[model samples]
Every structure is written in C-alpha cells, then in structure tokens.
Target: MDENKSYLYDFIKGLWKENPVLVQLLGMCPTLAVTNAVENAIAMSVAVVFVLTASAIIISLIRKLIPAQVRIASYIVVIATFVTMADRYLAAFYPAQSKALGPFIPLIVVNCIILGRMEAFASKNGVFRSILDALGMSFGFAIALLLMSSFREILGNGTWLNMRVLGSWWDNWMVMILPPGAFLTLGTIVGVSRFIQTKLKKA
Candidate 1:
C-alpha cells in the first residue's frame, strides 16, 4: 500500500480491529471509572484523543533524538503536558464534568494506552503516521467506553444519556452504577467480543 493509504488504514484500525480498549485492554482505570454516563465517556474519550494525538506528533518528531534509556520518561512528560491542558480546559468550561471525572484527568498521565502508542508506534513512525495511529486508537477507546457506559447508564439508572429510556415499571439495577457494575459490564462486553472474534476466525 502507498504511504497515504497505510496511514489511513492505521487510523481506522484503531477504531475497531485493534481498539485500545477492546483489543489491547489498555487504560482500564479511566475506562471503568469515568464511564458511568455517556457524557462522561465522551469527555474522557475526547481528552484521550487530544493528549494522544499531541504526544504522538511531538514524539514522532523527536523520536530520533530521544535516547532509548529515557524515551519512556520523555513520552510521559509529553503526554502529561497535553493531559494538563485537557484537564484545565475541562475545569474551566465544564466544571461539573471536570468534577465528575476528577482525578482521572491527571491520571491520564499514567494511562498505558498513551505511553504504549508513543513507545510502540509513534516513536517508530513519521509525524503523519503517528497522528493517524493515535487518532485510530483514541476512536477505539471512545467506542468501547461509550458502549460500556451506555449499558450501565441504561440499566442502572433506567436512562440513556440522562434521558429516560425505560418506564417507571423498570427497577434500576443500582449495581451497574457502582464499581462492581463497571467490572461486570466490562467483563461481559469483553467476553462477548472474544466470542464474536472466535466465531469469525472459525468462519
């Protein structure tokens, strides 16, 4: 494939085929912690996309100069800088969400998904390719979070994106909003995803 086509493929692959959440299972902390609602899921995903894309571009540009011994540290610094910006932006414009997301924003500094991309892909690719890879991975992460949150929000709260989906007859499953709920929902989703993958492979 041509360079342009390859870059596009990498970007799109992150959204589904090799999604950071479903496929690689990176950054589970924020994936489970902040995804209680669709809005929070979107916010977290957007923050990740911003930080990952920025760090990937910077890391790709300086990949040759960053010595292997300190490369991880450098990537963390780059990612932290972007995460700080995202945190500040959310705090200023979306205080409620910022409060709800809380420490997860700063916790992005330690998210394996960001660092993994920087070390495994961005550091080895050109600027454009790195950006595309980050975009794809971020999209994948977002989709997984959205799906999980949607399930939890709908069942646990009888709402989807804060809108009532079920009538009063439906008793909310409070477990879905708690930490255990996060695990159960994520576990089920992961199992289903694996099952589908297995069937596809057999076919």
Candidate 2:
C-alpha cells in the first residue's frame, strides 16, 4: 500500500503541482517556440514524452554502471541517441510536423527537463519509480503545451487545429501568434496557475 501510494504521488505531482513548464520552468525553449500552433505543440509533446520516458528507463537501468564523474556525459549520449531516432522517424513519416518542428527536435538532447530528470530522479531511483516520474513529467509537459497551443491558436488564428471555431465576426488577435504573445500567454497562465494553487491550499 505504501509503495502504491508513493508511485501515485510521484505520478500525480507532475500533472499540475510540479509541472515542468508551469511549475518547474524547465524546457522553456520548445514551450514558447513551437507552441504557435496546436499541431506543433502536440508533436513536440509526443517527442518529449518518448525521449524523456525512454531515456529515464535507460538511465535508471544503467545507473549503477555509470561512473559518477562522467554520468552527465553518458546521459547526454543516451538522450541524443533517442532524439536522433525520434527526429528521423518524424522526418520520414510526419514530414510536415517534422518540418515545422525543425531543429527543435534535435534540441531535445539539451532540453533541461529530460536531463534534469535523469540527474535528479532517475539516477538514484529504481527503474519503476523513474518510469513513473518520467510519465508524470511528460504528461505535465503535454498538458502545458496543449493548453498554450489551444489558447494561442484560438486567439491568434481564430481556429483550433486549423478548424475555425470562432465565427467570422471574431477578429484574430494578431499578437497572440507572435513571440511576444507566447511570453504574454505563458505569463498569464503561470500567474493564474499560481493563484489557483494558492486558493486551493487555503481552501
């Protein structure tokens, strides 16, 4: 029962309480860069989920074998390998999303979120625990990306996933599609999230 509780807590925490982007502020690059559209956000999230989970599993399995002095380098190599696989797979099959994402796919190798997990959670934990943590973090990332993308798409383009949701009367907020808009939108989200969290704690 205690073990199950532990796993559940670890998994649930990342969903909101400790979200990588909104909470922990990790992986801001992709969060702001690729979130101009819903499709791009989802694509980035999927790649991150795969890379983070796979790398966490691999790192957890081999943690004992890795020397402390060179563990960071080892982790990067493992992360880079999976990133390459994801990049090529996307480029081959989902070429449009692959093109949209472009260098950001390769940039995952250096994404602090993945590396932070390997160093902080996976390195010292058992494989099962690491996997749970990775899943939670990945979901957290996905949720944030989805929320950001949805908001940006609706306001900026007056569409969701390329389908017009708002009527023709609605004038799109051109700023929502720009770089400044990403920052503004994310800032608003983070602020509201914190406010809600504070209220929940009081309640």
Candidate 3:
C-alpha cells in the first residue's frame, strides 16, 4: 500500500473495526465511570482526544530513541503530562464540569487506551500516522461513550442532552442513573456489538 493510504487506513480503522472500546476493550474505568450524562461523556471525550493525540505525537517523534524495555514507563509519563494539562485546563475554565468529573480527569493519566496506542502503534509509526491513529481511537472512544451515556440518560431521566424526550406519563427508570446502570448499559452494548460482529462474520 502507498504510505499515505496506509496512514489513512490506520486512522480510519480505529473508529470502528478496531475501536479501542468496542473491539479492544481498553480504558474501561472512565468509559463506564463518568458517562452518566451526555455532557460528562463529551468532556471525557475531549480530554481523551487531547491526551491521546498529544501522547501519540510525542511518542512517534521519539520512537527511535526510546528503549523497548522502558517504553511503557516513558509513554505513561508522556500521557500523564498531557492529562495534567487537560485537567488543569478544565478546572480553570470549566469548574462545574471539572467538579462533576472529579478524579477521572486526573485518572486519565493511567487510561490504558492512550498508553496502549502509544506502545502498540505510535511508538513504531511515523508522526503523521500516529496522529491519524490517535484521532480514530479517540473518536471511537467518544462515540462509544456517547452512545452508552445517551441511552442511560434518556431512559433514566427521560431526557436526551437535557431535552425532554418522554411523555408526562412516562416513569423514568431510576436504576439507569445509578452505578449498576452503567454496568448494565455497557454490558448490553458490548453484547450487542459482539452479536453484530458475529453476524457479519457468518454472513
């Protein structure tokens, strides 16, 4: 394949086929923890995009110099630096969302999805390719979280993005807003994704 085309392929693949959340099952902690609302999901997605893209760029630029034995630690450090910046930015400008997200912003430092991409893809790829991969992975993560959170928020609160979507007669399912709701929603989504994949393969 042509070099440019290969880069596009790597970037596009993460959005669906090799999605970090649906396919690779990475970074589940924040994926399930902070997605109780659409706003929170969007915030988390932005943070992940900033951290992942920055880490990928840095790691790709220094791929040749980093020793394999210490690459993971180096990647974590790079990811942490970006996460800290993102956390501070949120706290400074969006205090309410920052307070709502709580420790998850700082916890982005340890998100395996970012680190995994740095080690498995960015650390061996060219800078442009790494950026593309990061974009795709971040988009994939965002989409997955948005979908999960949308379902939970809508069903549990009778609202979608804070817009009333249900009738006055509707009784909201309180369970969908609790911790168990996150697990149930994620579990059901995972199962459905697998089912779709299986059907596609069989077809």
Candidate 4:
C-alpha cells in the first residue's frame, strides 16, 4: 500500500507541483510555438507524451549498463531514436500538423524536459516509477499547451479546434494568435499560478 502511494505521488506531482512547462519552464520553445491552434497543441502534446514515455522506459531499463562518463551522450542517443520514430510517425500520418510544426518535431531531441527527466528521474529510478514520472510530466505539459492554445484560438479566431464558436458579430482579436500572444499568456499564467501558491502557503 505504501509503495503504491509513493508511485501515485510521483505521477501526481508533475501535473502541477513540478509541471514541465508551467512550473519548471522546460520545453517553452514548443509550448509557445505550436500552441497557436488547438490542433497543433494536441499534436505536439501527443508526440511529447509518446517520446518521453518511450524514452523513459528504455533509459530506465538500461541505466545501469551505461558508463558514467558517457551517460549524457548515451541518453541523447536513446532519446534521439525515440524522437525519430515519433517524428516519422507524425510526418506519415499527420502531414499537415507535421508541416505546421516544422522542425520543432525533430528538435525534440534536445528538449530539456526529456533530457532533464532522463537524468534527474528515469536514469535513477525503476521502470514503473520512471514511466509514471514521464506520464505525469507529459500530461502536465499537455495541460499547459491546451490551456494556452484554447485561449489563443478562441480569442483570436473566435473558434475552438478550428470550429467557429463566436457569433458573426464578434470580431476576433488578431493579436491573440501571434507570437506576442504566447508570451502574454505564458506570463499571465505564471504570475497567477505563483500568486495562488503564495496565498496557499500563507494560509
């Protein structure tokens, strides 16, 4: 019972306490770039979830076998292999999203979030624990991306998931779908989250 609880905690923390995008600020490049639309956000999140989870499994399984001197390089190689698989899969089945995302898909190789998890958690944990951690982190990342994309798409295009939502009388905010919009949303979220945390702590 105690062991399972610990595992649960590991999986839960990344959703908020240690969120890769919101809390740790990792993978901001993809988070901000591909979040202009809900579809792009979902696609990017799926790829990250697949790559992060798969890489964590492999890394944990082979952690001990990797020499300490070359562990970083080894981790990159392993991460790259999974990244390639994800990139190819996306390109094959979701050509439009793949094109929309562009090199960001391939650049997953160096995403600090994945590498950081491999080094900080997966490389030192059991397979089950590592898998949980990866899932948690990826889910957290997905949440942030979704929220960001939702705000951007709805306000900018007056649509949700490319489907028109607002009435014809509504004029969309063009700025909400641009690069600056990403920064504004991210900054606001971070600020609000921090404020909430501070209040909770004071209570």
**By lDDT, who's the top model here?**
2
**Ten-residue region with minimum lDDT total, candidate 2:** 1-10
The C-alpha TM-scores of every prediction are 0.96, 0.97, 0.95, 0.96
Of the candidates numbered 2 and 3, which has the greater TM-score value?
2
How high is the CA lDDT of each candidate model? 0.92, 0.95, 0.90, 0.93
| Deviation (Å) of 167 in candidate 3 | 2.2
For model 4, residues 60-172, the per-residue Cα lDDT tens digits are: 99999999999999999999999999999989998999999999999999999999999999999999999999999999999999999998999899999989999998898
Query: Candidate 3: which stretches are off by over 4 Å?
Result: 1-5
Q: Model 1 scores what on Cα lDDT?
A: 0.92
Q: Give candidate 4's error at residue 83 in angstroms.
A: 0.9
- Per-residue CA lDDT of model 2 for 48-147, tens digit only, reads 9999999999999999999999999999999999999999999999999999998999999999999999999999899999999999999999999999
Per-residue lDDT of 1-203 in model 1, one digit per residue for the tens?
47446757889988867878888889999998997898899999999989999999999999999999999899988998999999999999999999999999999999999999998999999999899899989889999999999999999999998999999999999999999999999999988998898899999
Write one digit per residue (lDDT tens) for candidate 3, span 1-203: 47446767887888888888988999999988887889899999999999999999999999999898998888888888899899999999999899989999999988889888987889888998899999999999999999999999999998888889898888999998899999999899989999999999999
Please report how far candidate 1 places residue 2 from its true position, in Å: 9.6
- Provide the lDDT at 112 for model 3: 84
